[model samples]
Target: MKWFEGSVADAISSAQQKRCLFIVFAADEQPASVSTQESWDSDAVGSVASSSVALKVTPGSDSYTQFTQIYPVTIVPTSYMISPLSGGPLEVVQGTASTDELLAKLQSAQEKLTSAGSAMAANTAGAAPAQASAAATAPAPQTASGAAASTTPAAQQPSNEDKIAKARELIAMKRQQRQEEEKQKDLDSELSRRESGKKLQEYKAQQKSREASDRRKEMQREKDEADRAREEIRRKIAEDKAARRQKQSGSAAASASSEPVSATAAAAAAPSVARPPSLPSDMARIQFRFPDGSSLTEDFSSTTQLSVARQFVADRVSDRFPNGFSLCTTYPRQELTFEVDDQTLQELQLSPRSAVLVLPKTTGKQRRGGSGAGAATALSPDSGVWKIIMIPLLLLQAIWQWLTGSAASSSSPSTPAPSGSQAASQPMPQASSSGDAAEARQRRGRGPETGSSFGVSKEGRVNRFKPNDGGDEDDDMGTWNGNSTQQQ
Candidate 1:
């Protein structure tokens, strides 16, 4: 069947204008509904529905809801045949029906509409003859009444038109309102979606930050564990070294105690003392102390000969001791000579760690003090006894010079001139001669002095001071005068 394409209200208006039965079919997507739709589409059902205005509505459509307001659809695949004139339901098919059944229903509803129209037309015809007879019998006054009656329908026609116009306006207003509500719903949904997306981004950022922090913490923890492991290893190694040293010391002491006193003494006096066999045979760390107070440390296998250690020291101190040097230990004060150089360092008790002094070898000529001239040149300036004796004499001489200078300055004009005999007897202050100045310079340079009798002389002898028996003025230079203004 061909269904009306307009809205439900329009379809109803069209049905009324055409004086036909209005048919509405409501259904959802179900097997029964599908069967009913197929039946309506058949040629038999379409032929019967041709005399009616047909409308199809689905469950959620606006037309379906509008139709239901007038004639409620209580079941799926429901059909309603409404009489346009009476605006009442003539037939209702509540469920699925075959094509023949739908066509029979359509025919029955159409016949009802036809009968109602015929009844209304017959009643109108009967009233028309009665109205004509009454008009013919009416007097002059009744004519005015009849004229007013004739204008009544014309006046009511505009009222009907106004009511229809109002109804259409209300429908348009409702449609506009529904459109606005849908727009608002769309906007609200869009805002909610954006908000959800923003929250998701924030959560992702927070997750990344937390993961980075966790990774950094893990790396730091691993580094800390590694450091602790290394520290533990170093501590263990130090403890082992200390324990080994203690054990070696204890063994050495026990072996020394077990030997006889005479043997111990002999060993102590020997140039190369035999080491205890209990000592470790590992590498030896030896420190060589030079005569100049500097030291060198070296490592060697304990089984190496002592001559190697001597050669090692010789190479380092070659500039200082060209002749050679000997190594000796300070504790027992034993010397290591060439005779015992072939012995291993372990046999000499120099294993693990030990200190050896470097002594420059002395020649036979040096031991005998050399020739006289050689001995004299070899002697250093007498720094101890000579400085002690000379410092006091130098202070006294300085005091005497200062006093004489002050006295001469003060008595230049007031003192009377001395007679020849008094002048001759008084010793006058004399400037130091060139020879004495030269000797003073030589003494400052730490060299032997030739002229000075008060300090160390050229022959390395300290000259003694004697009273001047002959009263020589030059010889009296060592004596201090008691009187300030006159010589005593």
Candidate 2:
């Protein structure tokens, strides 16, 4: 068998360079005869080819058997490998390949290739530089460097194990660098985003300050305008009040200068003013004087003027007269005067001893009678004439007794007169002359006598009686004469 040794990359090159068959074998304590051609195809030579290995053992038996399998070899595994060296003396082959083994055959081929690679390297390392260059340029399955680098000695070349370890280490270092670059890019992007947010906050704060300043200015402007308007209104109100006060003061001053006195004062001065002169051509002048020194003269008829004068006097006297005072007038001439009680008093306010009531004769019997008659009548009693004479006669007799020397006895006391009416008629001349006279006086004194005295007159006035003219004395003398003649 031709010798060759290398990894899968070298193996394909050697298979072409040496044109040798790569035989495989199993490894065991007792190798068995196994066939490799039946187990592995000739095309199985690449990476991962060393994963197949064969072991020889009988099914259900504790005994070993000949390995029979074929497999491609790339990298060796740590598991058991079986041998196919069985038959006759049970030969223990170490690297020979056989049937009935899979991974064992590929592993035996790898061992042989490895041994050959060691010998080739030894031969090249001991050579002169010229020979080393020729040998290195020669077709070798185990070398990775190009022909120009092959002049280097075998001792200077990297071991297959060492090359693989360094390749793995380089790949891991590249991956670690890529991960660190990615992490740096992520951290930079995060920092940039935070800076952008801080700038946005500053911008918003400045905008708010601008808006607040504008609003405050607007509010202040409105307040100033309102204050101006209020001041204008106050000025107008003050002007109006001053104008009204001036107008009222002017009017009050004008009123004081125009009028001299009050209406009551003017009326009181009327009585002192001179009367207008009367026209002589006018008929029947009437004139009067008022207490206030004012005089009035009316050119009207006397009767009409008298009527007006009477009404004026009644009005003047109404305030002074009391209820009991009466008026009596004994009118004997022209012009009228008022009388109170018995006499004609000039004023009702003062009492006078006597005065005459004079009324115009043209006022006729009507004034002498009518409502004026009461003013002329005297207030007296209602007793008849007979009692009038007898009552005074009895009072005289009583006085005569006291005037005489004898003291009057109580039994012979004089009796009082009867009032206005006599008793019912009876026989006359029953007593003697003196006794009759005494009895007659007693009857008259018993009660009130009736005459005009203290009685109301026919004119509805208070009339007092007066002494008779002559009729009563004649009647009494006739009665006395007839009695004396009858006694003779």
Task: Give the Cα lDDT of each candidate.
Answer: 0.72, 0.40
lDDT (C-alpha) at residue 368 in model 1:
70
- Tens-place lDDT per residue, model 1, 384-446, is 443444455455555654554344333112223333333333444346865664554443322
Model 2: how far residue 82 lies from native, Å: 47
RMSD vs true structure, all candidates: 21.2, 40.4
**Alpha-carbon error at 481 in model 2, in Å?**
99
What TM-score does prediction 2 earn?
A: 0.21
Worst ten-residue run, lDDT, model 2?
A: 82-91
Best by lDDT: 1
Residues 1-488, candidate 2: write the lDDT tens digits: 11223333353344435533233232233332223322333344322243332223332222212212212221121122221111111112332333334345445645554555677677666765666677646776455555445555565656777755764564455345535754676688678778888888888898899899989999999999999999999999999999978987796687668767777665455444334455333234434444344544334432233334455444554553332112223333233433322322223211221222312223446646765656423222333444455565555554554432123222233433333433211112132454454445333322112342221111122122223433343333221121123211
